[model samples]
Target chain A: MPTMQPLMLPPLVIETQNLTKAFGQQKALDGVNLQVVPGAIGLLGPNGAGKSTLIKCLLQLQPITSGSARLLGREVGSEGREIRKRVGYTPEQDCHIPGMVGCEYVTYCAQLCGLPFQAARQRAHEMLDFVGMGQERYRKIESYSTGMRQRLKLAQAMVHDPEIIFLDEPTNGLDPKGQAQILDLVNSLWKRYGITVVLSSHLLHDVDRICEQIIIIARGRVLVHDTLENLKARRRGAAEVVLSGRHQEFESACLRRNWACEPLPNGHIKVEHHSDSLNSLLGLLDEIKLPPLEIIPSPNALEETFVQALEISHATA
Target chain B: MPLHDTSYQHWEGVHLGLWRRRWVIARAGLRACLQGKWMRHLIVLCWVSALGMTTVLFLVGQLLVANSIVVKWMGNFNPALQAFAGMLTTWLEQHPEISVRTTQDVLFYYFCIGLMRAGIFALGMAIPLLITRDLASNAIIIYSSKAVSRGDYLLGKFITAFVLIFLTWLGPVCAAWFVGNLLAPDWRFFWHSRVAVAHVLVFGAASMTVLSLLALGVSAISSKEKSTAAVWFMWWIFGGVLAPIAVQTQPWLRHLSFNFDLDQLALAVFRPAHDLTIAQTNIPILGDMLRGVRPQTLASLATPELQGAVAALLVMLALAAFLIRNRVRPE
Candidate 1:
């Protein structure tokens, strides 16, 4: 028997194949297959979506059920320490040592990551600075705000300068500004330091802004895992363009031009076309000179896509 | 491979992390013990209680040893004093190494024994408090990084607790011995009293091992507040005033009491000042044994050795590892 050799190069720095986790009678993660590339990959899911479960399985903090995960060419379960050494993790919950100074806590974490004392200290200082926590580095963690505490957690995670970092809802309890600051720090860490980030969050906007690829999961199963482009492609069938001209004229003109256009009740024409024909609309506007005040491509309904995935997951379940 | 990294902390063994974690936690516990007014007050109360009990016991023992007319006269009216004196006198005669007189001797014998016994109890009591604090405050994860194994983390905590227990017992023992010697002048008899005191200390340390383990087990099983309640309730059931009563009321129940065996062991080990007519028993199989044999007795019976300490330490470290493994359920 002859087997065909594989063709597509795997983009993932970390990938899971039929990964599953169960807690007694309850299954926490059920047959999850996730491939995370070298850029920011968002792990989005609802409360029981198994985002945390997947992350924990990857870290080997929780045991896997049936399948396996690969991180940086190594299997997650058996090579967790090796994976963890190269990958940082900021837990969803606020884990703070009240009496220890921020620097002390980070330094200890660095040491645990196998850095020597002087080097750990140096790296800890650099990490604090990287997270914009330099001024408050000497202060005890008990005095830190929720934002500062979150930043401290982030700093400790990166103190060893890991190759990949897992941030589980890093902005979970933070204010908007705090969230922005943290996201900014996360973005910089990825952009400047070349750290691959697996940011797990329920907030779609956060995922939309930072992630090049998104995996939306619900109820312990993956609903979708694709590039943002693929997701937009998935939504292309219902594409609409709003026009601010005489609806009748625009409709007739579009019909004559063989463009699928429908007139709305509010004197706005909804022009429908394949994503490939978006260029044709622009070209039509230039030729016809039916200059409307605005020609806006309606934003792709991501919230709808999310709800649709949920519906699909629910129906399939 | 670079033999010399030219940096701090060249080694990467679990001990390196365990040592630092142990130091930090021990310092934190010591600081808490010293700084908090309530803790300081608690320590004061402990010292006061131990001192009061020791002084009373000493006075009563002295009265019995002297066989004073006042004591006899008192005994005529109250048979309680007569019985107590007679019992003490008998107790002293079996092993006479407990009551040292010279400044050095008294301090060595009484202080060491007092400190070891009282301090062990106090320190053992304090351990649950520290564990509960860490659990309650949710700060335990701060010092315990995911970088180290759970075994290493628990070993660190156990090491810290052990060191704290040692300090608690040692300090009191030194103080008690110093005070005992100051009150008395005869050095030879005092020296003889030292052996019993030393044995009591070893017994106290042995007791502490069990107490700390039980405390940790309780802490691992319950929330901090519940853990505190469990520790106190277990202590009352096993160690405090009710234990003796239960032992006395039901003769068979005496075998189950930790304190009963501990007290017996202490008495046997610390053969008081007037003790003489030594008796030794050697069993063919298990050697000369003390009163009760419970599950902990096997461990208690083993002759104290470096090898035994290492084995006990491994068992403790293993138990701690098991506790941590089951503590956190996947969310």
Candidate 2:
């Protein structure tokens, strides 16, 4: 038995150095150099943007054609076994060992991570409970619905209590309520449990709901990776404000505050919301007594960011 | 934004490492294979056939004992065993080790044959159950993403099928050996037949390893469960039908086309010091009564030599190893 070594995890959960994965002439992950800190990270990319490929490469499920990567401070390929022990991954496709029930499957996965059988069983049930699986947990995975299977996949991934969980398209094929339920559960992993969650999806709304960090990939390259606040802040001067007072007064008030405010034809002032937060703008309104009737931050700011990132990446390519 | 604490929390719990973890896959694989109705039935059927074959061999072994009564009774029919028994008893009394070896070799030969036949069906079922099913469900991703390396996964899968294959042969072979020794004239029977089990242990280990490799290789390359089964079944049918016909045209076909090679291996491993009269016919009065060519069991004189068969099997092992190694890649 190898003696357990105390972990010295790096500040970055994932760090890739010029990582490139190619199939013959086509590169799936082209010169991807990234340093990902731990948090709820949304990996957003178009179809064939190498989101799945990147996840697989980081997990070492797929061998990297070249370059290098590290997960949780352990070098990939060399320390893959130890890395895998602490990381949980679910690919986009549905997968389960046939004939095993949900609990058994999860327990089996836990055992594979080197947990003893009894502990594995206990942890399996714990994860199943955490995933909100009910009596149907006893049912074979083959008979599970898409939502149930998705939940089961998450349960199995977490059964080992991994430090990092990578979920690719986890919310794919779920209804709105099911999606919210899964998203809430996933949110808790990052929020309450503090497990690093790397959620890869095309659903901008899903990412916008929970992710603190956003990575947008296009043309097999990362166009942008920044804090969600920073990404949304890029759409500066897009916040709309409606005041109960006169429009001229608000415009004068905004001018006095030196905020980048634009008056649209619809009688609303667009303020840049300095520092990417509306709290300061509201404080200014309170001080000026230009009582605001409404404050509408750009709801599509992340969407625009995602689109513009892809466009820029394509343009550069 | 606050950066993470960056303190990796290694588990302080009991954890099984590489050496202890593979059994999980093997156990799960076994559960799945045994859960299938047809798989269970096929194993049961194999055991039943083996039991019957063992019973026949036991009865035949007894009839060959160098005693006077049976031979005296059959004297009028031929008087061959009576004279043969006189020389056999004299030779056996001088070199009793041959008698012991003869007893062990015949039973060991039948055990290998039964095991190979049963293993073919088990492989047909097992490849689909263990290998392609994992592929079809994309369970490979789940496994590959876990702590399991390709070698661990392959070993786990091999153990599952090998266990089933040996179970089909070992149980009946031991039963025959035990019962034969029980009814033997003295305690020397146990000493004499102790080597019988050795042949089975070595043969079972070697052949099953190759067969397990073949199963995994076929399963890895195939995309669907049905296709995996079809490939194995096709191999069985292809070799079964072709080997006989190929035997006529190509003398070397025995080494490559069919299972004459396996039989050749069995014959080589279990060759007795001297071919007993009863070993030829396996029946008391039949050695003289059947006055004809060699028994069907030994009729493969034109079959290629043992070296040829061994080279063919080695080639097969290499090919299977190549397929499995290439296909089970995480890439």
Candidate 3:
């Protein structure tokens, strides 16, 4: 019999069991069982990959065809309003009331989340300032730039002081600097304020910058769900070693030493770090009389893994 | 210079109840409506009619009181005071029925007419701005994503429109009443005319509800303010034009006029004894044309006319509610 490990973290903020959602003949989410631990979790997927669908189902904004979901330990459909009271959402689309200044719009949103008028107004100002909106906060939302509008959306999401925030493509239309600022803001929400953030985005770099844990969904299924640190750590010790000369002799020497090696078209040999260390590899190279030019660790293995997961899922589907 | 803290902070404050939260939308909408220069100008213009009606009441009260005072002062009056007293007595005698109609009752009648007109204009100007703009901008999603429910949002919008119509309609009437009371000779007039106040309150509430429902329903279905306003205008014009023609071609269709139904309902609520079958004897301009041709005369007050008015109102209200409910969801 196998024994279970002792629990270390708090209960999950979101838990779904066989969550299925269908639209007519098309299945948007299929038997997705997800347990999201509290903190910053990235929902990574391509368009139409059920990322938004899952979020909507979990939020009770969309009804599931079958199965159940819970948010903050409360069942989704039955306790959606209760869940919404404690959760904030920034949608991917442009959602704004026309003829309203930024401060009033944020205040109105905060009020909609059950904040008192005075408190909502105060928090709206605070949130706008936090999002780097200054005197422009008094300008009509229709007059705001794309970056300003993005910041305003973020500010409204935070104005109610929700425990968890669902940010869908927060950095979607931003410039590089704007994207960096938004990612930093997302990070600070989890780090400084301890707010759980479920950031859904197709941008891997944005997720990589802010998310501690990632959930990659493809074809209505969760392909990968693990910590970024663990995913990156798994690729460690694997390296590509290049030789200036005697490449065939070096490749044969690596195989004779019982090391797995494959020669690339770029004259670099892909070497797996098994029992042998770099010293052993160097010794083997010396025996072949080939000088090592460069030994670079394989980069962006997570990206490769993501691509592999997508490809495998597509092939299986 | 000290750097402003741009860091995220936890909200330590408490939250209000759901209804209070819902009021936030209404308050914001009301503020936005009041902020518009066009809306402000329209409101001012509407109140100007109220002010004119109040001035008429004030003059009527002054004329009534002048007769008694002038009679008492006739024994020791200069030629100017005598001359003024004779003119006032002649005017008082000429319009003796005006005094018979209590100041409150007259004000109520004027208010009902004023409010109906103002309500139409306010609904046309404000509802589109309030609802269609939000729809066009896709702001309903932002609202739905928050703690506010669809029903709460719709109710908040209804309240905003109701309050605006109330201000334009009842606000002026109440002001006129206050002014009339101040200008009256004694508290007897107010005490005797308390029922008119009740009629005003009830009529205002009913009219406001119907108009708000209809405006909001139309607003919900439209994506653009201009489109909503245009549709509402066309609805009125079509109804007005169609109802009269239908009534002229087929007398049975007299009750189909939206304006006719509303007029009958207003009469039933505010002046139940006034028979629409007879030509209206008062009012100088449209009285001759309105006399026998009024749509309500086609059916007796106890028969289909009043029933049709009530039924039409109910059907309109139900239709508006249905449209509003369907369109208020997250898109």
Candidate 4:
């Protein structure tokens, strides 16, 4: 994960301030503020998390209820056409002209992206090759595999050579190999071209692999938005430290030492401390004369952090 | 970077890119219609059925040698055939030498109907599928490239629909003209009449243009499946086998019919002595129905002329184009 850095400029390609969307009485997005930098950023959320709603408003693909979005320094709805020219989008749902060949389909996209005829054709070929679909370039899209179609979708988004691309669940139905291939393609885009990517996925592992920054949303609100490292760092106190021999006495001592200590179900002392270092915790145990049978450091689990955030946000609501 | 001028130039480039996208769609649609196995079969079937209908009519005519039997069977079996033959023969009696030209002309008229039906149906059936396929396969990634805007995408689709309709009708009309000339050498006399040929061109351009725009309008309003179903259902109901039945049941509605418009307008133009019976009955009644009064002069119906049809077609196309913009939304 990249360290959170302060830049002279905003360092954001996309910014949404107090964004909200409602359908009649039902609110789909509620005061969601997101700032995305000029690289791969993952959008993680469960179903009905307002991820789709956010994407729609950002692209001006649908009308928003309130708030605002800016892409490439222009307001969303007013400058949607201009914003679209600088951004490529691969929708979660397939949009294809069934009988059109891959080559023809890509070329059409290239043209819509403003390449002239000869250039469109050449770019289409190059795009297909980049997606590893060169062999199937002339084959009709209706006959393509799910993975191939996904790749083609990505290719079309990239063919116009947009500065930024939004890939909405690009690996939704792919096998492991296919998913990896898509991930590699996405990674390569950022590395080779410095293209900003906003990848939406429900899979944490996938997001963790490609995204340095992430925005996790739930039920139409931003739950958390920060670098992955910062998110993990927030879970520091949530970590567990186990001491087997200490038992009840060690737990009481740790509680007195200003550590949140609990007697474990396994009859050990489990400690959680945000401010104290590992050495301080060890010194406290030594000062208490509680020699441990076994010592273990629990994993810094993000899943728990995510659930806790959701629970806290929901309870407050 | 110079912001103002360069930004405008970039935007223009994107708009042009959208037009390029439309050309891709048009080419794909044409290729699909021309090559798809089912579409090819459908076209072949239309040609065979039309020729078969003509052959059956000729054979039946040959079988009925006696005038009494022909008259009795015509009155009982098919009223349209009977009325058409009676009108033609009554005209033939006044100008017997011209009967051959009239006969060939009638055949050409029927051939044009079959041609228009086949062309319109085929083109209409394909358009919605094009829209649907794009949505289904997630192929719109190409359309959303930095070069394309939503408005440009809509325009591209409009062009595709218009061109498809044009070519579909053009192909069959040319074929029918060629075949009609070969079957009846007397058709040359009819073609020699500059007025006759001019009328044919006007009618052909008007009716087909109307049908094409209607197809596009339906495509814009509905999804691929719904668009296809709606167009075919309407075609079958309004222009196909049920058309005559509808006319028979509702004589008042006959004036609104495509057949009625063509027949009345043609009579008002030619006014051949042989067509006195039709000129008096079918033509005048249809004219009255359309104009809502007895014909003061044929010049009234003829005044606005085929130009009205052309204008109507252009308007429908523009409306369809506008509707298509709303229909195609971003993800």
* TM-score (0 to 1) of chain B for each candidate: 0.53, 0.77, 0.79, 0.53
Residues A1-317 of candidate 4 have per-residue lDDT tens digits of 98988657646798888899998988899988877778778888887788877887888777888988898788887876678767888888766656678988777666655577777776777777777775677888878888888988888887777888889899999999999988988887776668888889888778877887788888899888888777766655533555545366776777787778766566555577654246666676689876666554433345665678689878988
Give me the candidate number with maximum DockQ: 3
State which docking tier applies to candidate 1.
incorrect
Per-prediction tally of clashes? 22, 1, 0, 15
On residues B1-331, what C-alpha lDDT tens digit does candidate 3 reach at each position? 1176666667776778878876888887888788878778877876887777667665545544445443446536565655564564464455443332433454576567656777777778887766888888888888878887777888889888988887788777777666765665545546555666777777778778888888898898788788899877777767777776875587546555556677667677755334222224543332576555645543444343568778877887788889887777666
Q: What is the TM-score of chain A alone in each candidate?
A: 0.82, 0.83, 0.82, 0.78
> Candidate 1: deviation at residue A165, Å?
1.5
lDDT of 3 by residue, A194-307 (tens): 999999999888888799999999989999999988887776656788776777777777788777888888878888756333676666666777778898664455677689
Q: Fnat per model, in the order given?
A: 0.22, 0.76, 0.78, 0.51
Instruction: Enumerate residue pairs that collide in model 2.
Output: A114-B16
Q: How does model 3 score on DockQ?
A: 0.62
DockQ of candidate 2 is 0.44
- Model 4 alpha-carbon drift over 4 Å, by segment: A1-7, A134-139, A237-305, B1-18, B37-114, B124-128, B135-151, B170-209, B217-234, B237-243, B246-249, B252-331
lDDT at residue A218 of model 2 (Cα atoms): 75
Reference-based lDDT, residue B313, model 2: 83
Using DockQ as the yardstick, the better of models 1 and 2 is 2
TM-score of 4: 0.66
Per-residue lDDT over B7-69 for candidate 2, one digit per residue giving the tens place of the 0 to 100 score: 222345967978778888887888877887887887787677666655654444444456645
TM accuracy, model 1: 0.68
